[model samples]
Structure formats: C-alpha cells, structure tokens
Target: MTHVQDGGPAYWRVAIVEDHRLQRLRTEELVGRQPGLRVVRSCETLDELMAWMAGGSPQSLPHVVVLDLVVDRGRDADPAVVERLVRSGMRVLVLSAMASVPLVRAMIRAGVTGFVGKRDTEEDIVAALWAVLRRRQWITPELASVMAGDAQRPRLSDQEERALVLYASGLTLDAVAVALGVKRDTVKKYLERVKTKYADVGRPVRTKIDLNREAIRDGLMTASTVENDRR
Candidate 1:
C-alpha cells in the first residue's frame, strides 16, 4: 500500500464507475483537479471497468476505484464483481447516495476500503480516496453515527467474536473452524449463538452479510483485522 509518509507516487491513479454521464464527468473533473490524484479511466458500468482492467497492463491498474453502489440506471453493482476487484488488489472507495447501515455494512464485508456519501463535497470524496490508498477505512460521519446507534446491539463472547470476524472476512465456515482449531459444527454453533444474541436484542442477523455489519459495529472487524486475516 502507498503512504504519504513514505514519499508515495507523484499521483495516485484512479478509476471511476458511475452510470450517469454528467455525474461521471463531474467526478472525473473533480478528481483531476486534486493535487496528487489522477483519473486513469471513467467508466459507465462495472462490466466496462472489468474489461478495462483485463485489457490493461498491471502497472496501468488504478490505485483506487471510486464506485457507485447503484449503477446501471438504479441497479445495484454486483457484490461478486466488487469482490473480484478487491481480491485482485484494487482498493475500492464507494461513492453512493445510500447511507443506510445495512448497505454500508454489506459493502465493507465485500471488501470496500472506504465509503463517501454522494451528498458529501468533492473534498470529502477526495479525502476518502486518500484514506483508501493509505490502507485505511473511512466512512461518512452520518453513517458512523447510525452504526453507533445500534440500540439493540449485543455483546459477544470471545469465541463468538472470533467466529464472526473469521467468517465475515470472507472465510468459509470450514476454514474458520480450522483456524480456530475447532470442529465445523462448533464454529456453526458459535455463530448461531451470536445470531441469537442479536435477535434477543431485537437486531436480527439473518445472513452472513448482516453478521458482518454487526461485527463491524461491535468493533470486531476493521481494516487491520481483515489484513491480518489475509496474511
């Protein structure tokens, strides 16, 4: 990862994916004006972005991708596509109008490095990109507040927390069980207990994505945590 402290590159390469023509142009212009940022490509769809990556040299890949969660005329960007980008080593900084906790949590679990609300100013968006390039997680204050206000949040046991983090970081249950030196069913029970706790508090965790969000809100997940898991 590049860092400002280490005298990083002269300019960070950027890719943008926004379906709206005017919005795409505006974002491209805004990013171009930044002192240490450059737009390498501005695409209208995830497919176009993927094709660009496949056709370009490794060195031509953008340092960060500024993505719109909803693209293609109100359709959601496929999580699988986002996951592919992240697994390929491109950090994603989401720029979206949706600031709800569930959606933000879903993106994070999909490996997004940062998120900036569309209502935010250009400066805020630029800052988010920088944060992602530096291998940090960033979120709008409003979104942070919403996550913090989980009134029905449940406290987790140590084992349950471990299970949540491993599974939420994109690990399979069997892999998580191996990592914890426990049986697969034991790992499942741990996660089930976690879900039950949330349900008891009136916060339902019906899916792995929901569990990921809860883990994040409870501080069990972070950029460093995920990086450590990768290592």
Candidate 2:
C-alpha cells in the first residue's frame, strides 16, 4: 500500500498515550492541525488508556493509537495493550523517543504497523502517520540507519550475549538456565536486563532471542554477534 502523505481529505481518528503532559499535548496539537487526522483522547497512563477504551463508547474509540513505549518509568508497556487495540480494530502507530532496533522489531512482530522516532523531523512524523493510515509500515530513515549501523557493531558481555541468543532461540527460561549452568532466576535476570535496555528506550521488551532476531534483521545483533560475544 502507498504511504499516507498525499494530503488527501480523509480523516483518521487518533488517540495518544503519553505520560508527559507537554509532549502529549504537543503531539495532540500536531495531529489536530493535520488535515486528515483528529485526536479523540489523550492519555497519560496505561491504566487510563485501558479504562477509557473499556468504558468509552465504540463511536469514541480511535481508529489509530499513537502509543509510546514508556507510559510510566517503572511500568513497562504491555504487549497486550497493542493486541487489544488491534483486536478492537484500531491501528497503532508508535511514536516515541525510545526507538531501538530490537524494540521496533518486537513492536512490528507484535503487529504495530508504524514506528517514528521522536528524533525524526516533523515531516518524518507526518509521513509516518500517513504511512500507517494507508496500511504501510514506516520507519524513519535516520532511525533505520542507526539500527543498521548498530547491528554491525555492539558492546555486550559474552554471557549477556549468550543469554540473548539462547532466549531468542526459543529456549524456555528454565532450559536456558540449565544449559548455561546458572540458576533459572539468574538466567531470567540476565534476560530481563537485556529487555530493560530497550525498555529504557520506551519500547516493549521481548525474549532475548526475539531481541536478537530484531537486531539481526536490523543488522545490529547477529547469530555470529552472539556467538563471538560468548567468547
């Protein structure tokens, strides 16, 4: 499908999920000023978003959600929210400063169609929204380059990389722990750390292998990257 930058006279309903008041309002304003987009609601937390969606009438529900990976510092964004929005027939266009190769990949794998980093220009942001409106996957060129460059170079501990690869390989937490000769919780913690790095960027954390898959796809983390780091 084509990207939604044609300046067409089509209107798309949108919702915003951001904890920062100013950022949320600014984004809402930008969407409001756009020709084919309108903001139905602006949320500052996941609970609020959930409650609104649950209690609000379907007519008020948005057609698209501008979701941020971090709604609250300690609270990780749940994949279930994205799933719920999609299940409810709302398209998600993630807009965040927390763009990471692994995070983007996980979001994409989880069915998000558009991702635009906050570092992107206004044009990039607009193009991204339009892309998602037209049912196309959009990633900022700058972010794409960063992802590509990072994939080719990384700084990670051997054990950490091993943990990531094994987790990505579909091994259960227990299985990974057994194979690594560490406590299950130890393995779990290691994996959680990897997730936290990406989470710090306001993106969902997936399994280590899943993270690696994202890295591999972005040319950031590879099978060899994992293997070489293990030594």
Worst 10 residues of 2 by lDDT: 150-159
- lDDT measured at residue 60 in model 1 versus the true structure, 0 to 100: 85
Best by TM-score: 1
Query: Model 1 reaches what TM-score against the true structure?
Result: 0.67
The CA lDDT of each predicted structure is: 0.78, 0.68
Candidate 2 clash pair list: 4-130, 98-201, 151-219, 151-220, 167-209, 168-209
Best by lDDT: 1
Residues 58-77, candidate 2: write the lDDT tens digits: 77778888888865554645
Residue range 1-231, candidate 1, lDDT tens digits? 233433778678899999988999999999888777889999888788888888899878898899887765655677668867777778899898864456565566566758888899888888888888897878787766665565666655445766787898778999988766699999999999989999999889988888877777666566565666677
Q: What is the lDDT of candidate 2?
A: 0.68
Query: So what's the TM-score on candidate 2?
Result: 0.59
TM-score of each: 0.67, 0.59
